[model samples]
Target: MKNEVKHVLGLSGGKDSSALALYMSQEHPDLDIEYFFTDTGEELEEVYEYLSMLEGFLGKPIRNLDPDRDFRFWLTQYNNFLPSAQTRWCTKNLKLKPFEKWIKDEYTSQGYTVYSYVAIRSDEDFREGLSSKNKSLVTKLPFKEVGVDRQGVFEILENSGLGLPKYYDWRSRSGCTFCFFQRKIEWVGLMERHPDAFEKAKSLEKSALEHGSPFSWSEGETLDELSRPERVEQIKRDHEKRLAAVARKRVVNPLRPDEGMVDLDEIYGQQKICLACHK
Candidate 1:
């Protein structure tokens, strides 16, 4: 008997993943792909809005794979320690687990050869692709295969009228509102735009510190210290200096005003982006 096959793509509400969905739909219309978003329950409002916009273009509903337990519950499970780059319990529990569970129960266990699509762009290091232990579950990097780099992703979103997510104006990547991978400037952006979320992160960090957790949401200092008026100004100035440096390095296109746009990752130096969270 021929083995059954299933195609699935996960969206992180970031430009690359959203663009991949559009690319797949436009280029390979015959392949039925199941697009899903694994909700951490701490995602920004803009993420939902962007996902909705993507759905309209795809003419299909993207499945929301919400975890059985939310971020708070998982935080408690990890003894209230804030997830850090060194220890990322949040991504495992809040993002990957739910998607894995859904895939295992629905496809793999039923003997389906699952083709999981990931949005690792061509410009990025190929080592960033998410690997699976299951032999039947194959990871496919369509962007890398098709040579769709950062600029190509921008064009895809631009041509599709989906554009980038609204949060792109402030935050570079999309995931939990209080993602630890965020730059100091992005935390500042969060504070300026979503004060409540910033406060919640502060509260969580306070609790974590009180409970003997070493990690702060931001690397060097607590949110309280970071939020001080003078410190905020310092962060802004530093970010501006870095932004200027990056801008000076790039060759600008006069006709395309949007050319050479820089993201937090570009300014802050590239980070090991969370595939399940930031993509």
Candidate 2:
């Protein structure tokens, strides 16, 4: 495990991965970890802003692994089909591929064993992330090893003073502006928050449908349908109902009353999240 290892961690600009980076920095300060974030070119402007703040705390520039081809190019390659939970070509071509290429081409080819630190929390079961075909590339789960669950992640971020990304107030997951994994409420949140991004998402979905693609960004309905005034209100009501239900079910600790915001995953149920983009 110690033959010229190159320690690296990928930041998803989400609470878990960002917290993990801070956790590793404070806990394993001696490891000399190199942090990186893969740019999908469709990421929210807020994500880039958050990354800038994170860079200050880490005291190192998180390398940007830009894909050789951007999202529009890949979408064209797939016949303009939108990447969905079922067919996540975006992660494959944008996130994982770039990481693999950067590590293998820049480091592994030179005989450096890459130790990729991932942010899989202890509360969750084992979920497969970016797996490497190369024997020398390895993944380390620091959060799971030290029993740091969701609350622990919250604490780590809060204590760091960097805190959660601004989007967490409305959306829990962070990825592309039009991430299909988002709940209906989050799509509504997008429409309200970043209207331009929401419109772009609608345009992409329109293009996909015109190209004979079967899926929309969200599930049954198109973004146009989802954004209608009444439909948006309904989605908001449903979200609030579920949020209250979740709040009632939770056993809140008196010690921390501030960490009681409703997680969207709890409302819609936990979908298979994007480890590379959402963490």
Candidate 3:
């Protein structure tokens, strides 16, 4: 007998993917899609909270695909170097590998075709990472198909009462609390909001440096260096300047001054962030 095709959507604990899930639920109720989150075991507390809220709305448990091996295990296997954009072993081993394993064993082994729904918005160009390797594993972008841009995504979340993740008020994007992709200001935000996590990142960086690793958690500085009073003041001042510049560039709608709140990519410039982790 031919196998049934399975529909799946991944939730990254970010606004875009969550909005995409809600949009799919409302717009395509007939499709029984399996929602999943690949937990890194190092994600923020707020990420779990947001996932719980999403589950409440979905009326189903978002499947958790945890790696058999944790971040530290992978770190050791990768020669103790911290994961950076140049060497993102964390996302590969912690995030993407687990998801691929789960789907391969659970769905593909049953000869089922998986149609994975991704949340690439209409305003954003489709990225190379969203592509699937297996012929049977098809990829879909509901937001792009429906013409839902960032504003539309915000509207969906607002109407759904999920709103944005709490970290957005300070930091932006979602992944591990100590994600190396964070801007220096975001590292400072982590230091202020979740000091323990910030300290853990510092310890990791220190160990990596002790082993002669080239990259710091953030560019051009270590977390300990970035957290010093004087350096913190400088980072804050630079962030304020950038925010003011972005705010000035905004043509006020006379209706939405709040729209001036800058995104991480906008302030720090876009990095090669993984959609599976940061979307």
Candidate 4:
């Protein structure tokens, strides 16, 4: 018997991946794509809500590729060191490992060639993606191939009626609640929006630091320090200044001139985005 070919798209509950999925379904409806979300088990509640909303649009079950173990288990294994941007063990052990294991065991081992669809926009370089080392797994960038950039992604989501993730109103990026790539402003946003989740992140950071780990959740300061009323005020003010600076430099888009719009990437500059966590 000949091996089968499979198409899979990963959703991070972020704009890009969701837009890609909508684009693929509209443009390549003939392709039988399997959408999946690799659960970190630490994802924001809004992420799950958005994924559920996305499923309603796709008219397909978005498979949940959950890890066998949770973050606490992995944290213990790593001697309680929190995963930092420099060393994102969370992305590897928690996110990617579950995804890789799922496909390799459930599909590739059964002689299936997995074609993974990534959301690297036309403006984005192919430098960031889950480029598989497995001979059986291949990566595809539909957005880049079709010249779909950031603006195009926005349109796709808007027109699809799926819109952006709810958390985008608070935090632009999607991942675990305590993603180390978060900007100071976003940390303050988390503290304000989801106080409990914020507390959990602080607890994790405290444990990690107690174990003598050089890395805190965010660099330079502890979460406790960041959460201080004075420090939070400073961060908010600094963010407002950055946004004003961006606004001054902004060339107004005649098509959709929403001047108040402030992209996190525009303010802080895009980080080395995690493929598994950020899509």
Candidate 2 displacement at residue 19 in angstroms: 0.5
Q: Write the per-residue lDDT of candidate 2 for residues 97-132, one digit (tens) a residue.
A: 999999988888888998999999998875767567
Q: Comparing candidate 1 with candidate 3, which one achieves the higher lDDT?
A: 1
Weakest ten-residue segment in model 4 by summed lDDT:
125-134
Q: What TM value does model 3 have?
A: 0.95
Alpha-carbon error at 249 in model 2, in Å? 1.9
Tell me the deviation in Å of residue 92 in model 2: 0.3
Cα displacement (angstroms), candidate 3, residue 9, comes to 0.7
* lDDT, candidate 4, 1-279, per-residue tens: 349999999999888999999899999999999999988888999999999999999999999988889999999999998888777788888878888888898888889999999999898874654666778998898888989988888889888999989888769888999999898888999999999999999999998999988998878999999999999999999998998999899998787775346788888887788877886
Score every model by TM-score.
0.96, 0.96, 0.95, 0.96
Worst 10 residues of 2 by lDDT: 258-267
The true-versus-predicted C-alpha distance at residue 222 of model 4, in Å, is: 0.3
Which 10-residue span in candidate 1 carries the lowest summed lDDT? 126-135
Error of 4 at 224 (Å): 0.5
Please name the candidate that would achieve the greatest lDDT relative to the true structure.
1
